[model samples]
Target: MTVALVTGATQGLGLALVEGLAQRLDPTDTVYLTGRDMNRVMTAVESMPGGGAEVRGELLDVADHQAAQRLAQQIRERHGGIDIVFGNAVMRVGPDDDPRVIADQYTEVNNFGTTRLLRAFAPLLRDNGRLLVVASSLGTLHHLAPVLHDRFTTPSSLDEIDEQIARWRDELKDRRTGAWPAFVNIPSKIGQVAAVRVLAAERREDDLHRGILIASVCPGMINTPTSALWWNVSTAPTPAQAAVALLDLALDPVKPEHHGELVRFGEVVPFS
Candidate 1:
């Protein structure tokens, strides 16, 4: 049976994705909805219209590396491998927030957390597996410092990307002003996009075994509790509208040229 997993599926864009994906999957297929809170997970599963039997719920906190590993093991044992993975989990820290604290949590959850999940699940992706990382336009290169913008857009070795992340963390910890607080989400999102490129390249360089497509996409400004706090929620697109593009990426036929690229408004755009 085909198995698909959606991280941070409790509400907003993630929840919309789960519903859209569940409706399309075959009766025998399973779509797992995951979040950090079990109550939310259960509630989301129960609330889906028509009560999708194929949809299930699990507790997953992307920031918790051990939990990711454990969940990966469970999926490996139970399903052998997964067909699709929508890395929809994300965090935004703003308002009444300490620069250091918000920066730390944002980096931990958005950048490190995503990469950790990818590493944990890479082995468990079956041939031709697809991964879609839910990214944001706010994380664009122009939002980053010049050097970092170059690194992210031009594509660099994973080690170099790690160095950049370390530098960012240090800058935040040292309380360096200017770029630190203004562009909090850029580093992690940039790292995630870079990670997608790295993964795609690795798959290409390795001996032809299985075809795994890795890609990151920015769903534009979506109206969600998270975005409401960060931006003018009134002007943002509905979660359903944003989710359509994401769902299209998740379900569409894989195109090799599109692999490792960042999609915006359903089109491939320059990383910069």
Candidate 2:
């Protein structure tokens, strides 16, 4: 069976991903629903209609290295290696609610949490298996390559800078958020594209060690508990809609042509 593991599977895009995957994957396939909150996890599983029995939620804070690492190890022991891994767990410190809390909190959940989850789940990924991280358009490297060049401690090249700009704008053209357009749709948007590029550079090799086809994905701006819903309320797709596209990218057994790339709706947009 093609087993899938998605961290932060309780609410918003993560919850949508779990539900969508359960529908797409075979009935007998194992789908693990994970989140930091047990109550949220349990509640999410219970709401899955007939599939609740097949859907099981585990308590996991992907940011907690030891705990998350242990969970990954347990998956290896119980289910061998994961066939599909979705690094969908994220921590957005602020959604403009309080800009002051944004820095530390954003770094903790969005940045540090991303690295930690990728590190923990790297070994759980199977050869030729696809892994997708639920990232934001703001995190695209194209946006930050120039602004953060010096701060990131990476030397910059003109080609790299031009590429970053072109790619960033191209990736942004699809919508405010690359894929979701609601939950994570940040005004001035967070640099999800940038984060994905960073992760691809640092974690691509890390993922390759496990034979995983990894790519970071922008789910667009999904309107969740942490977004500006009132300001922009047009044709907003649900988490379920976003999940469908994300699953398509994550399940494709293609080559590294798009590996370590940022994709949305089966299309690849340059980030690095």
TM-score of every model?
0.89, 0.75
Model 1 lowest lDDT segment of ten: 203-212
Residue range 112-174, candidate 2, lDDT tens digits: 566566666765667767767776555443454354444322413223433433343444444
Instruction: Write down the lDDT of every candidate, Cα atoms only.
Output: 0.77, 0.63
Q: Measured by TM-score, how close is model 2 to the native structure? A: 0.75
Clash number by candidate, in order: 0, 28
lDDT value for model 2: 0.63
Cα RMSDs of all predictions? 2.5, 7.8
lDDT of 1 at 12: 89
lDDT of 1 by residue, 189-216 (tens): 7788887777767765341345666888
Off by over 4 Å in 2: 51-53, 93-96, 145-147, 150-211, 229-231
